[model samples]
Target: MAEHAGAQKGDVICFGHTHKPWHREVEGIHFVNTGSVGRPKDGDWRAGYVILEMSGDQPRVEFVRVEYDLQQVMEAIRQSELPDDFAEYLATGGIPRPVESAADAE
Candidate 1:
């Protein structure tokens, strides 16, 4: 994955997953994950985003957290005719447990 991102001896790379935000240099390349916006299940309530600046000799990384209207999302969900349980989970942050797989039967 790192090679595919064009990361060489001195290149910058940025990627996001796992709902974690970070900024740092690896092997002379800068890598960053902007974190998650919707389900920032992390302890912090603030949603995550990232910014980069290359004007300076060294790249700059900025992480910003902004709050939006969650109720509007709920209201939209209400109008979508989706299942009530789904909406309830969104409003309450109560994730449903996943069903066990046969591989786990051992």
Candidate 2:
């Protein structure tokens, strides 16, 4: 936002790296994060995304969650060389458990 919109008023920014869908306004700037489509980390399962509708002067943001065939996804992964961790992630929407750090090894 700082780079593109420069904190301009009414500026809307969208991103999805966190895979946690959300919509909010901060400092007069609007932000929406369209969560992952194939693998969300919000623990709600199913595919997730956001839909923005500009009906009037204000933009309406809606969070959409769609259900897909989980069995097929698991089967395809099982038949391929993909890591089991990937399949597990698709099966569960929970954020990945943090790994132990070097400090924890001490």
Worst 10-residue lDDT window, candidate 2: 1-10
Give the per-residue lDDT digits (tens) of candidate 1, residues 10-79.
4567777677778776555777778777655444444568888887568888988877676787678788
Look at candidate 2 and give me any clashing residue pairs. Answer: none
The C-alpha lDDT values of all candidates are: 0.67, 0.79
Q: Candidate 2 local accuracy as lDDT?
A: 0.79
How far is each candidate from the true structure, as Cα RMSD in Å?
A: 6.3, 4.7
Listed in order, each prediction's TM-score against the native is 0.58, 0.77
Q: In candidate 2, what are the lDDT values of residues 1-106, reduced to their tens digit?
A: 4444554655677888988899877655678999888868888769887899877657899999998888899789888999877777887676676689999989
Runs in model 1 deviating more than 4 A are 1-10, 78-106
